[model samples]
Target chain A: MEIQRLSIKSLTITILIVIAGFSVLLSFVSGEYFFKAARESQLYSLNRVIQVATKEIMQQLHDQAYDIATALSIEGEIPKEFVKAVKGETKGELVKALDDPLITGFVGAYIIDLVKVRAYDLKLNFIAESHQGIQGLSPQMPKILYQQGYGRKGVARSKAISGLWQHADKSYYSVLVPIGGIFISGYLEVVVNPVNNLVRLSEKMNSPISIRSGIDPKRFYYEPKKSTEKLLPIEYELKTDLGASAFLLTSYEDIAKLSEGVKETVFNTISVFIGLVLIVLLIAIWLFQLLLFKPVNLMLNEIRNITDGDISRDLQVKGLAEIAILSGEFNKMTKEIRSREEVLTRLSVIDALTKIANRRKFDEVLKNEYLLGCRSGKPLSILMIDIDYFKQFNDTYGHLAGDDCIKKVATALKRSVYRPTDLVARYGGEEFAIILPDTTKSGERVIAEKIMSEIARLNIPHSSSSVDDKITVSIGGYAVVPSIHDDPVFIVAEADKSLYQAKGAGRNQFVLRNEFNSVI
Target chain B: MKKNYLISFIVFLLLVVSGIARAEKPFAPEKLQGTIRVDAEAAAELIVNTPSLLVVDARKEVEYSKGHIQGSVSLLDTEMTLEKLSKHAPDKSTPILFYCNGERCLRSSRAAAKALEWDYKLIYWFRGGWNEWVDKGMPISR
Candidate 1:
């Protein structure tokens, strides 16, 4: 099975995506933490404001209760009337005394909501209540009032006592004032409902406030209007003048809304952040393509052209510093390759010992020229030359001298050919051949005579010759107007045969044969 | 050898001075057992309501006369002998409240501890003491 590999482009994109994903996740987590912190701080401030407002309202209620208690206790006329009403044992008279204009007028002078007022005897038995419904005192009232130091003895000592009291369905803030001059009589109690004050408190604090009766859980008062969402049910047990235990429950939803706002801001910030990240990534990819990938691709194509034997042009230098340096280095490398290739090409065709075209080059040129001559109907000629008694010359002067003599002969023969189109090649050891592209039989004879004269002019010494005392060469020549049916090798064979004839006759002469087999 | 002796003498003098400084540091109160701790507000409330409550200023007579909570009587911790307490509070069941300068002062806690040892029925230790009372702007007497 083959596994697909990731390309650089795809890999870069994948890494960018991973980084973006991680950043988004980080933003989400931080946003959540920020929301939580903002929510907590909002709640804390809300709680503080509610506490201050509640304390102020409670203090106002306490002052009102104190004022009422002080007014009733210090007034000698009210205490005397209350004593008469109790002694007369007339319910109608006691009710009238309790609701007299002086007492009601004095109570009404304080503008706070005085829900109910009642009078109790020293034994804490019910005497008279201002509200319509008559009620007997709670059996636990005496014990609670005594424990709070607001009992009959407490009133005698402290002059007055105010406290909160809760029944089955109602809670009240009541002040107990002892009705006596020096000896204690019945008690005059003034009760006020705290719900109205709580309402004002709710408005001041901008949050919902309520009171729950600790003595009777069913009794709830001053509950704020209904809300969509409630938060932080802060319950504080109040230590007030009342004997009844009560608790205040307050909730603030604005803090929750503030947290929602924080979340919204966080989401918006994250969105903008992600958008910027994407833009940056795109720009980065574009820059990579422009500065690196494109330059690298151009360099790759240049290398391909070089391998394909088209190393004529150099690479263009451009782009960023590193890529430009790489391009320069690549160009230098291709130039070196081309120079080495030229040297190798030259070395492959030239004869190493004689500094002339070798046999292999000769064969390639002969084939190409023959084909050309056949098509053009041009007369092509070949000359074959041999060093006379070259082996005997070697046995006498040694092979080194023989080699020196051969070099001299090769040079002389090369000098004999005048036209640039003619070629001279070292045919073999002690042998040479020349190809002339456009020459007749007479022209071939002329070149062969010139080669013989040039070789004779060299005047090299050869000691062991059966013909002359110096080195000499035998030459053979052939010329023909090539036809399509003729082979180029046939010209070389004819020239070789002529060279055999020249060697057979003597050592120092030339022979030539024309296309029609006539000797010249 | 004389130079070595001189160095040793200097080292000994430094050690003695540091020891004296450590020993002269003021005493801090530790946790007290078998007592209920109250703040200035609760103590003031109790003093006002409970007639039998004895507010003992557990400092020296000079420190107590400088400033103290209203209705509180001076009763130094050093002078809180059994005979002295019995003379002031004939009934051992009377509520006794103790206080000093502040939390760092050990006099109030020590007096409360002595009262506990004497088997007083009710004991209240106002840890915030005279400093908190003045800070709260509560009524005080000199």
Candidate 2:
């Protein structure tokens, strides 16, 4: 399309599409960037929360474990039987301690009173199965809890150990602290199940999460997609409190699930944002078409019509400044054009000097009247008038006076032809022609006599030539009722003959040609 | 040859000195007040008092997140604005400023100076911007 033909709607839509497309692409790219940023930030925050929570919970557990041990140690100091049980000589009390409801929710906590070489089994009795007796499984058997007997192992390992360990053939996080006493060498071990912590943390987050602990060498932790074997990275940290075990605070599955959910949220937000932009673009395009394109087309259409010469219609539009201005301009232009055309038409048909029909107009009227007369079988009449100028009029007066005289005589001739269909023309210099529709030869003669008398009364100077020079004019008249058989040129010839006769008769006279004979 | 070299050297030294002087001049009014480098906070305050101040928000859409100062309008850094300004900015004497992602950004500085060439006076700069306002716990109304 031509550049001018391009409408605002197309331009606006193009612009909006470009803007919206760029916005969408930006949202997609930057949304991903934002999602990654949010994920990183959330992970950092969640890690901190888990660390704090684990430390607080561990502190509470440590104090409780110490209290339980203190209670047992005091009881052992008084009761001989409790003292004997402490030496791996009795298993019932420790078993009773492991089964306590207070320790159920906690990562299993128990004390190995090292004063006795025999270990005390508590909190691990269910998972600890030995072919030997329950007394033998006091905490030393599996190498998962304590490698050697309680006394030897407790003394040999670091005084406080914080690291990952295993139980039930699965890896777990463990925190062990040695408690040196007046009589007994003892240590307290706290094992926290990371799985439970993961479950709790997941509940708080807007996205999904999972936790796992006590895995084997390659510990397979919580998985978001159970079918996927690939393990995404888990950001875990070992946490410790004064009284409780160092625990692993991490939710591998939760992190992955949260990332996925964040990605989805970013996608959804971007989609909605892009959708809103698209809607705005559509509205803009619609408004452009209504307010800009359609009105401009109307202006163009009106302009096209005016150029094609149909100036009758009005351009009707409103509500825009530029369009209103253009419409006003268009109306003004059409009005000017129509008025100018009227002036040109008048200039073409009227005589500038005499203010009467000129030769061109007379010829047009004669042809039209001749056609009408032929169709209606009505008579058509013609008169040819010549001024009886002595040439001496110009010789005596001046060309200006000659012109004045001619104008007066032409006016008289015009007054003589009175019918609506009659036309008088300045045929040439000092000569005039009259068309009389539906007039016969006698009628033509009467008109000629009237014109002759009117010119004679003007009494203009006619002193120096062969004719009486007081500005009289010779008149020739012819009339015929035209027929289908008549030739238009024949009428003019007959008028010419009568004019020759009047001129031949001595300058100032009238001659008429009837259908049968010529009369003068 | 020596005279020509001396002349060339003088021209070169003059060019260098002039360049350095241009660079050192306190961001010329032309560069200071255009849409490319507007001072957002001052522009916002000015807009509230006099709405004619051209307040261009140059923040990347994301940094705009911390929330824009009120009365700061967004003008894409790349969009041509000379024609728009001629039509819209009836008063040449009105103030104009721009702001982007706090102090770490360069978009606002360039935009501010671009508006200055059109003969706008009263150019102001808001260097410590979005981050500072948000960090201070000031209320972002929108």
Count of backbone clashes for each model?
4, 28
Residue pairs in clash, model 1: A162-A241, A163-A241, A163-A242, A164-A242
The residue-by-residue lDDT of candidate 1 on A149-251, one tens digit each, is 3433432333455666665555666666555422356666666667667667667866676666666556676565676365556555554444345655455
What is candidate 1's lDDT per residue for B6-89, written digit by digit as tens?
A: 999999999999999876655545556888898866776687668898889998899887667656788899988988888778
* Residue-wise C-alpha lDDT for candidate 2, range A29-126, written one tens digit per residue: 99979997997888678676655654554444444443443333222331233344545565565434433423333234532211111222232222
Q: Model 1: runs farther than 4 Å from truth? A: A1-4, A25-34, A55-196, A213-219, A225-246, A252-263, A284-340, A416-420, A439-459, A517-520, B1-142
List of chain A TM-scores, every candidate: 0.67, 0.61
TM-score of chain B of each: 0.83, 0.56
Candidate 1's error at B134, in angstroms? 16
DockQ of each: 0.02, 0.01
Where does model 1 sit among the CAPRI classes? Answer: incorrect
